[model samples]
Target: MKNLMFFFATALLTITLTFAISPPASADVPPPPVNQVLGLFDATIDFTGADIDREFCQQCHVGSQVERHHALVTPTFGCFECHTLTDGTFAEFRECTFCHQTSPHHTTAEAQARHCSACHGSLVADYDDGHYIPSYATSSFTPLTGGVEPDPTNHPGEYAGGCKACHMEDIGQGIASNATTHHGIGITECSWCHDVEAEATLSIRKCEDCHDVNSLHNIQADSDNDGVITPGTETGGYGHIGANADCYGCHVQSFLAFMSTTAAEPTIPSITSLSATVLTAGQAANLTIAGESFMNTSGGETFTPVVEITKGDNVVILYPLPAFTSKELITPVPATLEPGNYELRVKKDAVVSNKMTLTVAADVQVSAANLTEETIVITGSNFGNQPGETTLGNTLGTVQSWSDQKVVVLMPEAVEGQTVTLVTAAGAVDNTEITAAKATAAVKEKIKGRANKGSIKTKSTK
Candidate 1:
């Protein structure tokens, strides 16, 4: 009876070992639940909607275990993946310090460099300075894509600034104005983003991302008191002026460092042509200069352009004060210019353009001459709006009427082969004349021996 009882016990033990060691009867047989204590896990934490935060993690991990995830792996695993109480939200990144000692996560330079990749490798895969993860204290900033992708074509350098510039509380005033925490990253504390060994010169070259180039904050105030206000100036060209809040509260220091380190290539102004080659002296001339990159807005910036006219031993600078465009500038050339040859050029700040030749010639030209009964009408250009004087070969003619293009003077007591001359404010000159009459001595004798020096006399209105 004892042997039979022992045999049954051995057989029972054998059957138990076989069941435990055997493979599943079929692949369809469902595997065990991922969690051993599935019932307790379900009862403790609701996998559905819940406002989860750092305090909520304590229920399972107890004290520090809540923050014990590998710091390097956290970004990949993502706190929200398991902190599953909230959807699309993670505990403030500052809470990351509870378990990971950021003060000295990696001791060596090589190790620290590698350490930087653990968190930033995935976040900045595309060099997107705008990448951000919302904190439990704040809702996720929407459309998390479309951040500034700095490259050689757009934003030449690594100008993402730092994570705190847009993702930290109090500091992220540009786009992360609603940010409640640091989102787990410190801008200055991270050796990779800033030079913790020295005065923490920023590595990614930020601020211009959201403020100047991005057109979001458009902070173009002259905060540095330099009097020059434009994008890429000494203060990153984004000042606190007119800001709804103190925009410089965080940017003042970082931006100064950025400008000092990076050199922005100025858009040099160019000159293609000038509208007029000759300008009248003693008369204002509207001169239009065509070019590229002529800055006019908020004038007084360093790149403001001015026209420089240089004569043999003198120079005249003209500013297009009232208004101008990037492609053209119409400025009144002062009447003060003397009659002479001059070299004209456009100067943008200190950059000078190619020289163009301009002549300030005597401003007068004779177009035609006609003889009316007892008067000679001289038609030409630049005949001074105000009446001047007219002469006919050693004889003075009585001025009948005078205008810029047509000047009529009573016929002088003259004869054939005589010359007619006009004198105006332009200059004392005989630059214009009428052809001598072909009439014979008999015709000259008919009218007191006077022959019209130009066209045949018209019938007298008298």
Candidate 2:
């Protein structure tokens, strides 16, 4: 009886081992093949083999899959992550629309039409001529499908095919469905009807048809995508179309007529000259800026004229002056500017005028050793090119000549070694050590030399 039990246990162990070593029932099936054109697996490549791994599938499929499939698949996602294997058969992976039905372009007809301006702005302008419906209705126009000619007698407005007769099927049902019903069709469905080569050729022809080759309208085309049409030599050397001509928005109008009637914007302010080009540093002076359009007379929120003084690339000082009439603006020079050669420019409403040189000179110096009775040369920087007052002690002296580096002044009746102050439009510079004794000593030395020469001549004569 014990021996029979031992034989039964051995038979049970053998059956259990056989089941564990055998492969799964579904392993016999093959995976779908990889579609080379679509770059996806489609019911042909074998996936049920034990040797097939996720890395094997990745070797063939790479990069972005968003254009084909909206969902992104990275290296981490295995083939089974998106595609499920149901009862040994791989689930079919369809196109992007299979999952995401309502994309941005398919949301509404208005949304699609609005997106067309990103590429086909010129086409949209041509369609606004109020002749799109008539153009499409003409019997001479060829339909997209061959052998079926358009019947002008059966013209239906915004019904049946409408714009879709020639345009692709992806352009929404008809023209009436979109927000731009009056504006006509856009190029949202361009890829459905034309290839890349055809699209390039059609774009050129569409722009040329309305604008014409070498015409003012064509030369001023916004082909550079700068949001404004740059005026070319054809338009009398006008720079920016926005500043030169007014189209009153983008409507069908005579370009020449608009250019003739529309007045160009006021010319940019220019700096012809400045009242004082050089001035003493840290002194307040009234500076005059001469230029055209210095004041903004056109009513509204008035723009205050500003003076910008810059040293190299850095802005040293900016003074905002009150509004004034005439072609000149008189403003106070700020006292904060240090001694340097700076560029002064006038700015109004963010437009900078021409630049002029302005020198902020260092402090003045008086030569106490070289003081003369008639003339005293005061050496200083930024002593402007005009004569000014010079005060010796309490007496005011006459300015003989003045320059950026030196000022010559006629001395007044005053004690020697007294404080002398030179005052100009730039401001005042005071020196306490200027002495009249230096002039007296110089005169005595000259007189003594002449007396000695006379005595020597008398001795020789005797």
Candidate 3:
């Protein structure tokens, strides 16, 4: 009896195993793809639409079960295969074409038109120029098999198929949508059509567009670079002038372009005439020319924002335009500098400016009047500026006092100029134009000679 009972239990276990191991009836049909069947198993979250910012999928899948499966399999049997691809790229929702049979691009013509006509009851009658009903109609005389597709025929106002392609026509702005068409995906591409370069700008179409200054000009009234942009009461440069806004707000129109009527006769209005004349060395002079067109706004479009002044390879920056009156005044130039040849310039942002040769001179020493161990004074009419020269031989000495009349100098290395000679930094010296001052350099030279002879007794001791 015990043996028979054991045999029966064993026979029952064998039957259970056979049934469990038998293949399914439709075994000839291949099993669905693992990805298709388990594409989102235990991973229902839509990555694009999901809150990826806070949670990673591994949080839930990380466990002994997954870890055990992971040891021998590429996807660790379950975890990786479910959440990610072998390349590490998280799988997209699904290949769009898998079901749609169209380009994988988001919004094909059929998809875009899917929502229309069915849901919009009143818009159902929104028929094409033809009288044919969408459901019952056929493009050909014979009955259509599946359904006739929407046409892109050259009908008067209809542009199907490429709805988005046509809707992207100029909205009057200088920029165009990055996506060519607006059909299929309908309006979702509006967000996708971002200008990565941010080169495009939108313009206001109505009063609201104008009133919304922030949206119109993209100008925020933040004097400091802090992220917060404060709004102020006063109007100036987009904000209150004293309250962090400049005086340019209400004057947005002040970009007042340069004048246009500049192609007139070739003549400088301010320049009566130009001439060259020699003046005593160290003399001061100014270059002047008159032209009323610097304020001309007619040629404004031709001038861009960048401005620079150039003269025969020499260049100077003239940007960040300064205030100037419509009426003329002496224009500012680079000044208070050592004497040298200069191209006198006056510019409005450099593109339009008056220029001329401006000669500058250094204080020239003409002759010596007073002599001392530490100092030698010169007597010359232009001495203050053309201060007199004092030299023992050839080397130039340090200048002390100068005026239009006489000059005094402290000798750096003693130079004896017994014979008066003129010299300049340019190497040419001699100003016959200078008048004698006080005791006069010639007479002073004679007196110093006699003094030197009498003082020869004292000189031997040194």
Provide the RMSD of all predictions against the true structure, rounded to 1 decimal.
Answer: 38.5, 38.0, 39.7
Off by over 4 Å in 3: 1-288, 299-314, 317-327, 348-355, 364-367, 370-423, 426-462
In model 2, the number of clashes is: 10
Quantify all predictions' global Cα lDDT against the true fold.
Answer: 0.40, 0.38, 0.28
TM-score for candidate 2, residues paired by index: 0.29
lDDT of 1 by residue, 101-175 (tens): 333323446233333222222111122335332333311221221123235486442222223222222211111
| lDDT, model 3 | 0.28
Query: Taking the tens digit of each residue's C-alpha lDDT, what string does model 2 give over 280-309?
Result: 566666666654444332212334456667
Model 3 TM-score is 0.22
lDDT head-to-head 1 vs 2, winner: 1
Top-down lDDT ranking:
1, 2, 3
